[model samples]
Target: MRSASPAAPKQLSLPRLPVPELGQTLNRYLKSLEPFILEDERHGGLAFQTALNLRKKWADEFATGVGKLCQDRLLALDRASPNNWLEDNFWTNKTYFEWRVPLLVNSNWWLALGDDEHVPLRARENMTDLTPWQVRRAAWLVHRVLSFKHLMDRQELYPETTRTGISLRDSVAKMFNTARIPKPRCDIHSKPPSPTVFNAETQKIYIMVHGWCYAIPVYEPTSPPRLLDVQEIETRMRSAVVDAQKRLASGASAVQIGALTADGRDKWAENLEYLLELSPQNQKTHRTICQSLIGVSLDGPSPTFASVGQRALTSHLHAIRSTHSNIANRIFDKPFTLIVDPSTRAGVSGEHSPCDALVPSMIADWALAEGIELAQFKDKEPAPFPASPPQQENWERLDWVVDEKIKSECVDAMARAKAIIDDSDANVFWFKDYGTDWIKDALKQSPDAYIQMVLQLAYYRTSGEFTATYETALTRMFKRGRTETIRTFTTESRAWVLAMLQTRRNLLHHAIHKHSSLTREATTGRGIDRHLLGLRLMLRPLNGEEAALFDDPLFSRSQEWKLSTSALSAGSLFSGTGFGASYEDGYGINYLAAPDMIKFGIESKSACPYTSTDRLKVAIFDALAELKSLCLATDGAAISQSQRAEISSHL
Candidate 1:
């Protein structure tokens, strides 16, 4: 007999990675995209369509290739003007249609590159045309190369120098000046160079991610992120639930529940009906619905059936009665019963409370039982919850009213929407444990070297716990003469930055121990790489939409696109209120306490995370819309003279 077919390859937790391409794949896509900028078509829609197609191609073709491309491009462009692209000609020319589309597209790719160091190797074998004028320069401008070679190494292709007075850090500082932002270095006590090239080594990928963030300062761009759709939302929700469930099943406590209270059985029926339509055969629609419910419910501490009842509410009983509860029992055996089900006589158990609105610890009973009870988010300082729009949207509305509170509420909602992440050591997984074994993985082996890097500034009052600012810590660093090293940081402080890059990896680290022994910390070397994995998963639906929007020929006109609140979270692209922009702050994970951080600094990718069940989300890239106005050539309001001078000094 044919042995049971080997278990299907485990579904990848991350986004489907595109094949490796040249380091300049983005540069090439920009070249192709550049032509689309000037094609004045007889039909505006046609030009729009062409541009849309170009955007899709760029987004798809160069997405993963962007990290290294951006580092080099920023280095090269830093010479032409400032290293930062936002406050310079790149922004100025785009509005004038002087290949701004290409620059803007380049900006988009730059942000996508993030802080990874391995980017260059992911590109095609040949990385030659990186600085080709055809590919790199804006219209009406000549080419210049101001990257690392001349700055840190002091080597220019041609040597007619006005002054050779600059130091490596001086040149790096210059890149900031050229970009018209505040210079990067502060007045901490200086130390002699490491003598060795590596002063302090961090994971190459983290450094790459860090520098990319510094390049754009784009995460909290003026605008916000976007939302996802029903099916996609359902999938993400289910995945988060599975994440929580695996924890409970293995013996860990649930973090918190965060979702819109389930609609009564009516919504359940509707969702199931929709599924039935998608699968018309004498299908296991009921079983499938229950199956999905089981995944979500099991994540909590209450029996899986209870969680289901809570999410859907009163009619939850009817749905359970009609549903095949056995579907849930297979995963989590709770002696739950639906009054109407033929086999079970267990009637309504208690006054099943409405899934409480997001308040810390409110949903503890039905939500997985874990986490400390925070003060009524209301009772706490109002800082983390920014002022909602003049009008918060009714959750049922389809338009663009994404009340940011909804996200916090939703995250904390079931445990009454609170954050699932916490300060307990159990919630953390120190990277040092992984050793350097990452070198053996085929996917990681052969990473690109860095000429430039990204840095994430995490502000924490130096005490071993979370506090509002990094100012105190910086002062401490200066006092201790350790400002330059991320390594010298105390463990508590390092956890924030680690959380940013590693994201859910910590959760999984805390989790795998309870599920499969192979996944335990002892076997932690078989890793989750959570942040990347979650990003990969979050990207699928976004790419699908990008494909759709890319195909739309009438995409450019004022009427071509619609903006709404839904874009407020995870939609990769949208012209709406910034989706979760506040999340970029250094401690967005504890955002309820500190919202001002959004006004400054590199984003914290770990803040909202994939555990957020809100389908209503968007990508960090959408923030460009807000930043766009700040970028106008004539408008330097956002760029203060002091900041400009600092940027200039580096030049």
Candidate 2:
């Protein structure tokens, strides 16, 4: 009897991402090009009318010619894809895999967790020995994170929905037990055996200490396995720390194989292959890391800085790109790595290929909210021994077989990583001024759009020019959707900047409204950038037969992304979040606009003489203050004295 396999359990259904009409996308693309044409110096100087007409001609030809073919191909792809067209066809390979640079500071995103108040700053300074608080905090975090994973496994965690009750795509399945594996020309992501089930092997996590890697189980053996309690996890961690210390005291040196992960993709691929060939033990160890749930680094104390913002910056930097001394204490390929220092100062650095930072940050928000209570150990000794002696054999140290070739490669990789760390100029700026509440109530503006305007003003004031800018817009409303670009540098925005320069307030509101409209379009899957990208990828290998619109100089210039910016949720549980700049001569700005204040994480390269994080920080402050004054002055008598005084105090 053929039993029609009970119709596959009705899966949570969401609409597929729609491919915007060709004409609509083309029209939007031409409008976006206007800002670039206005500043074009090509052909000795492009006259406004002449350049606009030429661009229009190109757009007309593209809309009817090769562009139509590309659009048709894209539609065909959408029909064939099970979920999202961009994701199934070319998103990851085009956006992430083909980019061969080291992921250390260039591609990975980092988030610094809010401080654990139980462990104060003074207690962390110049700390040499491992404290009980450190182990306990690490254990508690691990337990909480595993609990989040369990909720996900059981589907007990409700699906995240939009304000209108539309379900956002689920990416949490990829956030754990995944790794981005590097290959010759393109990298691939490794998948877990079962995303919804946990076994003894799948329940393990790897820990790195003093440039050494060790694996420990996080689930107890039972008829139905249960997560190890905090005390039990702490026992295992303490045992590993003790073993690492003893090995160091006996003068045993670690090979720093993790350094290979921080090298260029091709180089790392070669080194990894060679190491595996050198010993069967290395192959087993490699599989263990790739299949483990996640990696946690028990790090040493970070160098003390002058301000809390600086301390946050240092903590995030350590998580993303470690110092040369312990550079090998990280596996940057892991989907997420939780880094905790001696004082329980914590942060997460994630590989960007498997999913966006938002996916893991959601998990972090849950884990960070439940801090270990002071009462848990108030009356106990500083260091509590495990009631039962710890099982030392359960911890397996990951050892690598290194020859001269691998050793030399490690040295080169370390040098390259160190250079990047030194060149990064990262700053965490806490804007104590008013935030979303003031923007919505007093200025009557969208907080995100207002911040975009502020960034435009800040960059123009700093560099004396406006360049191509990118703001990420999530398309999670569709099944398996990722992000679409919201091009923030528009004619309206430029006019507003000039108006501000001349103290003319007429165009400010118009510009903000335009940005808000663009943002809405992007979030709804009608953005110009992703559609254009999909069409480009659909093009067949062409020998000078491509669409004229794509070959136009403005097309390439408009996407340079000199100012790459994105805003996360209020982020009350996070100190700051950031990613590297897309261009060497530009800046990367990620911010959190809370109800009462804003926090910004800004990064630039020190080698770029025109870009300075410190200068940008100053400019942001000036722009925000100026905008606040203008808003209040424009609506005089509308702002009450108490509200004015409150805003003044925050500044």
- Candidate maximizing lDDT: 2
Question: Model 1 residue 187 lDDT?
Answer: 10
lDDT tens digits, residue span 1-651, model 2: 977766654455567899999999888988898777766643357777789899889888888888888899899999999887899888999999999999987898888887777665565665675556677778778888888877765656653333212232257777776788888999998756663575455778999988888998988776467888777777788788777877777899778777889889999989888988999989878888888888998876555422355665555555545666557888999988888877676788889988777778888888988887645443333464343435656677887878999889988999898898788888777888899999999878899999999999999999988899999998887878889999999988887786675443445677789999999999899899999998888777665558778887788999999999989889888888888999999999999999999989898999999999999999999999998888767743454566545433311
Off by over 4 Å in 2: 1-12, 41-44, 120-122, 160-169, 195-199, 304-321, 374-392, 542-544, 635-651
Per-residue CA lDDT of model 1 for 508-553, tens digit only, reads 1122222222122112212112211222322344444223322334
